[model samples]
Target: MAEFPRNDMATAQDWLRHAVAADAAGDVAVAEQGFLQALLLDAALVDARFGLGVTYFRSARYREAALELRAVMAAGSADAATGILLGKSLYLTGEFPESAKAFELALTSMPLQGDSLRCYARAKTYATMIAGNIADALADYPALAGAEAEPIETVIRDGFGLLSAYGHRDAAAALGQLLITENPDDVVQRHLNDAVAGRAIDHVPASYVEAHFDAFANGFDDKLVNVLGYRVPEQMAELVSRHRTAFDHVLDLGCGTGLAGAHLRPLAGELTGVDLSARMLEQARRRDVYDALTHAEALTHLAAHAATFDLVFAADTLIYFGRLDAVMAAVAEAMTPGGIFAASVETSMHDFEIMPSGRFAHADAYVMRLAEPYFELLERQATDIRLEANTPAKGALFVWRRR
Candidate 1:
């Protein structure tokens, strides 16, 4: 009843074919048993071994699959095709370097084999991510060498550069390593990340905003006022009323449509506003609330004109920054000793701390952490800012004295 010649171990080959067919048809259990049956008869069967390994892989039994494929390689049956597949199995089990070695073997045998080449390239990329500068130092092999380097390699390198710079020496230095002097573009992407990271930000003025705000400028206030529940101006007025004698000049960071201006109109001896969106500034300009309007990266602009404000107010600007050190440090330098800094942030209770998400729902512990180094917390009022993108945005109003 065996599907083979009943001699010469022909049953092994027939069972292996049945396993492969059943596996292709997605009958994993039957395929696994058939592959096992084939291997029982012919212990030297590489096809049945590999088939069983793949079946374990499809069943999400990555450890078992890895064990089997590792045996295949140990048995010296790892050709280019089998080596690449085995490397993938190792990668699934989180053995990255071992996976890379397998991919390297496949690529070494068939250097231009498309699948092998791609897998090999990706394995190296994964190693770079885990190792950082250590990996870069060890990998003396130029990642993008030769005129024939694949376009995908550059993208992977750029992403690595961004991640590296975020935590590494500096993103700029990482970019230097990743830099392709041929036209040498891609600097802007790193700058964008740097800006978002609360590092030195280079403001790249976009013309799109001129048109964007040009269209929305007229009704901008009405939108924020009515739709967004933008009580920034109103809330600011209340804070200023309570601390009216604290400061003489106010620098409104990210002042949109002069909402802060109207609130501090009575308190500000002079008012200046900064925003990335020129269209938003255009709307703010109409209200005559600011003595000056500058289109610059908000913190850079603040740092350039430091110690000028008796009070520096930012409502909802901290959301863009994951860390508050740079902005708060700038505020400390920009304010006179004991100058008051009042602002609104998204705040939440997180393990008894104010976290970064204060722009939405964040730990109050992270909020307090941001406030501690730069300013002494005076008063904080928790309130709902308004619905944004169909969801309500929560906020906290804090008054601090710059230390």
Candidate 2:
């Protein structure tokens, strides 16, 4: 084993060399530590900061990467490469407007790079659409059309159309039209069909959920609580408090940003959280609440730690699960006998339905029937989960004890 140099013994240049070598050798975590050590020795070492930023970018810690890269640029240490990376990090963190600006800056140096141009265009489109700025997004259509080949252009057009239609509350018709242009055997088209018809798909794709939350991670707390009026986490905490004041071990399933953990910390001797998004886990780590936080899919994490938790809570987490059978079974296996499980679901008339927003809604009967065999319902009630497009979104909250 090689002994690494201590921060006090090594100069910033020495640390920079080692960090660069480590990064090129694909030991990014080590490279990040090395870069941090270099920065400690010399705070203004541009190479050290840039190396750390790139390491964070590679690790998919986009928010951290963006902050570091922004600092590097503000200090006048930026180049085309740094600008490109900063743009990518911003885009990954859902800061689309800023991402577009960063990409555009990169283009000033590398003007003819197709990849940069495409990324810039995509960022602008997503920024406009997500902010509900339809006219601005449509205004760029002509330029976007000229940039891509026919097939890619058509997909982009349809994607924008779907976003526009969904914004206008006509998602079903727009989805149908998009599917008509797509190959019948395409998996996404099939999923769109199921979503449009209000039928549950086999299951929500893990990739989709991971990407969605990963992008939303940076602003998740503000977007959920302030912008969307989300309160499921607090509601779950309150419901659990009424039943049992304390738990030996608690699991926060899909614990995005540790919101539930913040509320449930007092009730738990040990708190563990799991989510599919690494970026979301990063945010949760900042809360300093959970004893352990794992970046893993919910069922996979539960299976690995079966029968370990006395209580499990998932606030607004089940929306990503189009079907509940497998997940419910997994939770049952993961819980100790008589363990409590509290969860929330968007309301649906059918047993389960996939909405145009790509979330699942479960009927009250569906939740009750599924859990009846393995758990006993302690409490179930209808509640307003959040505000969607200036309207309250109705949902059901339930607390069940494992049988």
Candidate 3:
């Protein structure tokens, strides 16, 4: 460890030197105390603030590290080291957009280091995933073009190769990376931060769903049925059939490639399918099951035609929604008196959580609570909605009757 020169008079500089020495010697608590003392002596000392921020980062206190580093930058004392640390701290704290900006600034100040490049790429990727901005996400990909040797790059390469063999590599890789990380705890913690901060949207963005399903339309059935063993359509159809054999009018919400539509076609006098993806609607159109297929979001399409349907089916679709209140209200408004709203959702212990897969899971009590005001719970059943990594994905199938 390197030692700093100390003044005999024990000024702020002396305190800073002692603090650095303590930090270098792995005495972070003592270093923190010394750094605070130095700051108290000379509040304008940039190095002391930076050192303190670094100490907090070393201790894995990312929020404090971000605060201290942000203060240092706000005070007009910016440097490559400070910017890199700030970016890393922000990324760890789940402020991805700000982290990207910090990394960009750091790159402008100095050449990209391997760690900084990895953090920058991850920040951009996360921001794109949250915002559903593919163009902006691709803009950052150029930065990673030469980052072939980085661990993240290696993971991404391997992920893409695997997904490519299965088809739809880009979308699959993005979703897969969230599930397959070197440190799942860190990724899960970031998702928790997103959920707690309300940074995770109530519903998965329409743009994201549209883009995903559009890209997936061609291979959707094969991937869902064969690869993932998705059986929600058949399961939900059976659940609805048990209650009623037929309906006057039916709405298939999120009717992705019309899997549910195919199952529910026999039960509907007039079946309408609505989805965010035009490509998905195109695929559904070819099925010739739905009388009408509209390219629109579920809630928006539901709200547009109120009291128009007796049965609304959303098989495996509600998993994209973190909060059920608004959607449930919309469904209630859209259905006729004594109408049935049938949906399936991934289950969780919490009221609702944004999972590492970027999907939302809801507790049974939470779903029921949201439906209480406008509808009555008719049926709820535990079932395997799909298979992930060859394991059953536990979920709940819900049927609600409009009050």
Candidate 4:
């Protein structure tokens, strides 16, 4: 091996100079060793730590890179370049929320363009899907840390809409708790508070679902179809057409705003729709496609109804449920023998996983297992459900038959 600086008596500056030279000459191993030596000689050397972090990052040692970059940040030596590097390191390690904050800081000096900007946007979108993690509000409002509760509450409630929407649950829960304390009947805030506080919930509460869809019923169609490019209903309708041409009776479970009802109407002799949201039912009723629209939960209606339907389909509805045992059993019981069943689900590896976006994705195996006793699998097709955060959300459509 060539002679290299290994003397304990060598000054930190000497090691740092050698490290910089090695780095410039692309001698990664020597550069890393020199940087470590420089940091050992002078623990407070931010330059040495930054150099080590760059070496680690280049070598794809992301966790090590983050440690050194974080140390540089804590040393008050962070600049736009440091922030960008730190952000990239955190992002590669799947710390999207923290990465977003780092990228945001970098934007103060760096031009708002290129990979950094794209990464920031993607990270921010993913961050919003996360819930239950408390945000350090002090970062944005250091002065408010010691301020009175009244002012903090006011700020969160009145002016922190963007922060709350960004999955900063602590700020949102603070505001929600304040609102709930003042008005006991604020169901919306109560539900939001429960969700962010780690309350046990197998599925979204019916009241919450009703209120949510009711509030959005007016713009639901335009938002899903035009803005989000939602095509699950159209895809589901096509799936049904391939397996069967028509049915004497059809049930559209959780038929929201009549999106699926309109498509299924042509194939049904008598179509019935059921939903938890009355506002959604009102919108569905406007289509005049269903012979009957029942304002009730899908499972409740399914449990009560006899085996009269020859076709049952739910388009873009199963995402609210983390467990399909109860609903699947109810659907199985409600359908006539040899009847068709079709539905769509966001896909995951787990039997079922509650996503950060407050939706559930089920493994294909789980769905097949649930339907095995009651139905024969006809077809399973994977496709993009919709645009979430400007990215295609992958999901599967399943068609089955009652045993």
Instruction: Pick out the ten consecutive residues of candidate 3 with the lowest summed lDDT.
Output: 160-169
Per the 3 Å backbone cut-off, how many clashing residue pairs does candidate 3 have?
0
lDDT by candidate, in order shown? 0.65, 0.79, 0.78, 0.79
Candidate 4, residues 175-204, lDDT tens digits: the string is 567678887886655666676554666676
| TM-score leader | 4
Q: Tell me the spans in candidate 2 whose CA falls farther than 4 Å from its real position.
A: 1-200
Counting clashing residue pairs in each candidate, in order, gives: 14, 1, 0, 0
- Over the stretch 1-403, how does candidate 1's per-residue lDDT look in tens digits? 2233345556888888878888877889989988898999988898888889889878767668877777788889877766777777766554556778887777677763454455455455555555654346335324523233456546455444433423333432444444444324444333433433444332222332334445676787787778667776577558756865545777888776767877666677887888777778877888886888888767788788777788888876665454566677888888887778877766555422222111224456676787798788888887777654323567778788888
- Identify the runs in model 4 with alpha carbons over 4 angstroms from their true place: 1-185, 189-200
Which pairs clash (backbone N, Cα, C closer than 3 Å) in model 3? none
- What shift in Å separates residue 284 of candidate 1 from its native position after superposition? 1.0
TM-score of each: 0.45, 0.57, 0.55, 0.61
How much does candidate 1 score in TM-score? 0.45
Error of 2 at 8 (Å): 80
What would the per-residue lDDT of candidate 2 be over residues 258-341, giving only the tens digit for each residue?
999789899999999999989999999999999999989899998998788889999988888877999899999999998899
What's the ranking of the predictions by TM-score, best on top?
4, 2, 3, 1
Segments of candidate 1 deviating more than 4 angstroms? 1-219, 348-361, 389-391
Q: Could you tell me the lDDT of residue 286 within candidate 2?
A: 94
Winner on TM-score between 1 and 4 is 4
Residue-wise C-alpha lDDT for candidate 3, range 56-113, written one tens digit per residue = 9997778889999999999998898898999999877667678888888888868776
